[model samples]
Target: MLLSALLGVCLIPAHSKPAGEQLGSPLLQTCFEEAKKIVDDAYKYSREESLRRVRKEVVRPHDALRLLKQPRGGTRSAVRSADYMAQTLRLLQERVHHVHKRSLNVTDLLSEEDLNKLSEITGCASQVTFPSCRTTPNLNTYRTANSVCNNIKNPRLGSSNTPFARWLPAEYDDAISQPKGWDRTRRFNNFLLPTGYDVRQVSNNILSTTDAGVVNDREYTHMVTMFGQWNDHDLTFTPFSPSIRSFSNGINCDESCEKIEPCIPIPIPPGDPRLPTGRNSCIPAFRSAPVCGSGYSAFNFGGEPKKREQINALTAFLD
Candidate 1:
C-alpha cells in the first residue's frame, strides 16, 4: 500500500461530527479522490521507466524476427533466432512482473481508501476501518456485468454448471466490443482472472486451467510482486523480530473481548469443500471477505478501526 499522510495519526477532525453525519458527509468522496490522485501519480512515476525497459527487452525478439525474415544467408541457420525470441519473451515477462508489482503496491493503498468508502457508499456495516489494502475485483463493474449476464442465457445448456452458462458470453462479447464496455472490463479485471471466471475462484481453479495467456501470466506475476513488496514493507515497519521461543508458553494476545467473552472456537469440518486437500495444501481454515463500513457500498477489508496508539507507537521512528 502506498504510504499515506493520513496514517499514524487520526484525521477525523477534532470537531468531527457524529458518526452518523460523518457517514453522510463528502469526506469519503474526497478521500477516494485523493487516493486516486496518489495512485495515478505512482503509476505515472513507474509506468514510463517500466515500459521503456520492456520495449528495450522486447527488441531482442524484434531483432530475431527481422533476422528470420532475411534469406538464411547460406552461412548460418536461424536456430539462434528462435532462441533469441524465447529469451526476449522471458525477459519481457520479468519486466512485466516488475512493473506490475510497483503498480499494484499503489493499488493496495488505493484499496484501503476504497474499503473506507465502501461503508459510505453501500451502507453496509461490520466493515473494519484500518489502513490496510488488498486488490480484488471491482464490485461496481462486477454487479453491472452480472446484471447483464442475468438477462442473457445459453439455451442449449440444461445445467447452469457449465462455466460459460453463467455468463452472457455472446452478449458480453457484444458489450466488450463497444469501447465503453471494453474499458469497463479492463478496469474491472485489471487484475482479472483469465477465462473470465470470478476473481475469487481463480485461485481455486488456476491449476485446472491450461490457458496461460499474457493476461494470466501478468496477473500471477503482479500478484507475486505485490505480495513480495508487502512482505518487505511489513518487515521494515515491524522490525522487532522476536523468535517463536520468546512466546514459548503462548501468545498473550491481550485480554479484551476474547478474554472477557472468550473467543468462540467453532470447529470446522476437516473435509469441508472450502479447504484445500492433500499434503501440500498449506491453507488456512478461514478468511474474511471485504464489506462496507457504515455508509458507502465500497468494500472494506476487515471492519476493525485502526488502533491509533498501536500504529503511532510502531511508527514512532517517523519522528
Candidate 2:
C-alpha cells in the first residue's frame, strides 16, 4: 500500500507535463507576445530620454562632486542591467493582470519555467546570468574596487553593485512585485499603514531638536558621525532609479505627487512646521534600483528574476 501511494504521487497528472510547457498554451503565448512589444517600446523611449538628459548637462563645482560619486565602470553597467530587467518584469506583470479574470498574484499563476521563458524573450536571461570571474594575483593581496572575485567559490558574493541578501523573504503588498505600503487602501493585520509623509511629520514633531534640547556628548567628536556615515556607505549604497520620468506615462517624477513607479513622492501633511502643505508640494523620491532577476516572482531558476531586491553599490562585508 505504501509503495503504491508513493508511486501515485510521482505519477500525478499535473506533475507529468514538462516544465514551462504551459507557456506554449495559446493564452500564455499571446500574453507573452503582447508583453514583449510593450517592453520593447517602453525601454527604447526610456533609454532615449535618459541619454537626452545626460547630453544636455551643466556641471557646476557642487554638481561635479555629485557626478563623480555616480556609479562607474562595472557598477554603472550593473545598474543599467537592473533597470532593463525591472522594466521587463513590471510590464509583464501588467500583462498578466489584464489577461487573468480574477485577482491573483502573478507568481501564483506563473511558474519558474514560465518566467525563465519570458526573461529569454525580453533578453533579460543574459543580463541575470553570473559573469565568469577572472582570478588575479592582486585579488589575493587587495580587494577589487567592485568586490568581484572576493570569494574563490562564489565570485559575485558580497560584490558591489549586487543585490543585498535577504535575511527573510520579501513581503511585497502584492506578494510579487509591488513595494510595501504601495496600495493606500490595502490593509494589513486590520490596520492601514501610514503614508510616508505622515511618518515624516511624526518624526519632526517627536524627534526634532531645538537649541535648548541639544545636548553635547564629550565622549565622541564630529569625526565619529562622519566615520559612521563613511562606514555605512562602504557597506551599502542603494542607487535610485536613473530615470527622472515614469516609464508608463512619461510623467516627470519631480513634478508629480502621484505615487507611481519610480516616483513615491512624500506629501507634506497639513500644518507642517517647515515645508509647505499642498497637492503639488511634496518631496520627490525615486524607488531604489532593483537587482536584475529579482522582485518579479517567488521562484528563482539559476539566478533568474525572483522577488525585487535593491542593489548594494558596495561590498556588504568589511573590506
Candidate 3:
C-alpha cells in the first residue's frame, strides 16, 4: 500500500500481473530495498538512530504525477500516514548508521556511487508529462498606488489552516521543527529567490523596499497540488470564494441571453414578501446559463483551453 501510494508503478499485485509488466521502476525498487537493508543493518549492528526530518521542496512530484496517470485512490487515512512516517524514520536512521560506519560527519564526502545515484533519480523528470503551467501568473513588485498586496485578510470569518503561521499558537515552542520567531517572516533572499535571480532595491525618504525581479506579480498564484506518498507532508488546501453580484436599475437579465434571448415570465415565488407596490402574480426569475470564462495561459500546460470553472478552481485553491 505504501509503495502503491508513493508511485503507482504496480497497478496490481506481482502475481496478478504478467512477466512483461511485473514490477515498478528498477531505480525505485532498488531504492526501497537499499533503504530497507540499511535500516535492518542499523538494528542488527547497534547503530545510532539520530534521525531528523528537514522540510524540503522536491521535484519528484513531476514524475509521480506523470506515472500515476489517473487517480488510483484518494488519501484519507491517518493510520496509513502514520505507518509511512514510521518507515521514513527507519530510512533516516539507516543513513545515520552509514555516516558512522564511514567516519563521515558534516565535512565528510560521500562515495562517488551515492552522488551519481542521487543525480540519476532526481533528473528523472520527463518532458512528456507535466510540461508546465501555461497560464503562469506574472510576479511583480508591490506598489501602494496600484493597491498591490499580499498578507491581506480573508473577509469571511474563518481560521487560517495553520495557526502557528498566524501567531495563534502561543504555546508553540518547537524551535527546531518550527521557524524561529524572528526568522519566520524573514525569507532569506538567496534561498527564496531562484538561482540567477538579480536583486534591486526601491526606496523612498522614509524606508527602502526590495524589488528584485518582475513588475506586477499576480494577485494570487494557483497551482494544482496533489499528494501521494512513499513520502509526503501536511498541506492545507485553501479554496477561493467568488464574488456574487446583485444587478438592479435597468439591468435586464430576463430579456438578455443571460437568462434567455426571448425572455418569458418565470415564477419568482407565490406572493413574494419583497413585492413592490401593485405587482401582479409571479415575475421573471431571469435565470441564466453559466457562460464559462475564456481561454487563458493560466490553463494547465499541454491541455485543452481552460473554462470558467477551472479558473475558479485555481482561484479557490489559492484562496
Candidate 4:
C-alpha cells in the first residue's frame, strides 16, 4: 500500500512529460525502508514490527516537520515538491493506522501480481521501466502510439498565472478537433475570457472579424482565452474583467436593454419550430434575461458592417 501510494505521488513516465522531480527525498528514504518491513514476509503479523517500523518511520510528528523544513524552500518547485512530500507522508501514516486496526496481511493488502509489477517498474537502481508488450496487453500502440494526459510541473516558481502549463491534449484536444463541422451551427455559444492576465493590454480594444468574446459567470458561461490570438480588438475597452461583460447602456443594464444599445431579443415565440423539438412547453433562449444583443465591438477586424454582422451572429447563438 505504501509503495503504491508513494509511487502515485509522482509516477508519470519520464517519456510522457519531462518532470525531473524526485518525489521522495534522501531523508524520506528511511521511512520507506521501515514501511517495507511491516509488509515484508519477515515482519508480517508482528505488532513489534508495526510499532518500531511503521510508526517510527512515517507516523511521527517530528519527521513531518523535518521534511517540511528542507533547505530547498526558496524555489516554487521546491515548495510544491515539499507539499507533495508532506501530503504523501500524511497519507502513508493514515494508511498505517487503518492497516494496523484492520490487521490485514501484506499479501491481502496488495495482490502478488500488483506487487511484482510495481517492483519491476520501480527498479532497485532507482530507475523506472516502460512495460513491455506482454506486460501491457491493454495498450495497443503498434498502429497508434499510446499517449496519456499529464500535468508537467513548471520549474518556474512564483509566477502564479502560468505556474503549471496544464496538458490534456491526448484526450481533450483530439476530441474537440474531431468535431470538425460542429462549430458552424453547432447549437452552442461560448465566451472564454481568462483572468489574472495583464489587464492593461486589452484596454480600448475592438473585436470584429478577428475578435472573439470571453464569457465567464461560474455558471452558464465559459472562461476563454484568445486561442487564436485575434489581434483586431482590445478586450479592456469593453472593460474586460474576469467576469461577465454584458450589454449595458454605460449607466444601467435594464435601461440599456430597453433601448437595444447592444442587445436585441431572440424572437422565439410559442410553437416556434426552432425552439428545441419535442418539448411540451415553450422555452426561450438564455436565463440571464429574455434578451439577446448585437454584440458590437470597438475593435472591428476588417470593416464595419462585416465585423458588426459577425458579432451579431455570435450573440444570436442560443447555447
For this target, which candidate reaches the highest TM-score against the unseen true structure? 2
Q: What tens-digit string does per-residue lDDT give for candidate 2 at 1-319?
A: 0121122111123333343333222333444444444444544564575455555665334233333455666666666555554554454456454455445445545655666665565445554566666646577788776667778788878877777787998888877567778898888998988876776688788998889998889798899999999889779887765555676676877678877877777778887887778878877667876666666532434443356777788788766
Error of 3 at 209 (Å): 53
Give the candidates in order of lDDT, highest first: 2, 1, 3, 4
Superposition error at 281 for model 1 (Å): 25
Per-residue CA lDDT of model 4 for 1-319, tens digit only, reads 3343343222233343222222233213334433333223221222243245334635644234323322221122222222222222333334433435543322223334543432332221111112233443343433212111111132212121111222432221113211222123333235433321112223313332232465446754322445323321321011101101122212221122121211221222333323332322222111111000101111111112111111100111111
Full-model lDDT for every candidate: 0.27, 0.61, 0.25, 0.25
**lDDT (tens digit, per residue) of candidate 1 on 140-239:** 3443221222222322122111111122222322231121223224544356324212333455556444456434553466778898877654332211
Measured with C-alpha atoms, the lDDT of residue 220 in candidate 1 is 63
Residue 102 Cα positional deviation in candidate 4, in Å, after optimal superposition: 41
Q: Model 2, poorest ten-residue lDDT window?
A: 1-10
**Please, what is the TM-score per model?**
0.21, 0.70, 0.19, 0.15
Clash-forming residue pairs, model 3: 134-297, 135-297, 135-298, 139-217, 140-217, 239-316, 240-316
How many clashes does each candidate structure show, in the order listed? 19, 6, 7, 14
Scored by lDDT, model 4 comes in at 0.25
Candidate 3 local lDDT, 149-171, one digit each (tens): 22233221122211112323222
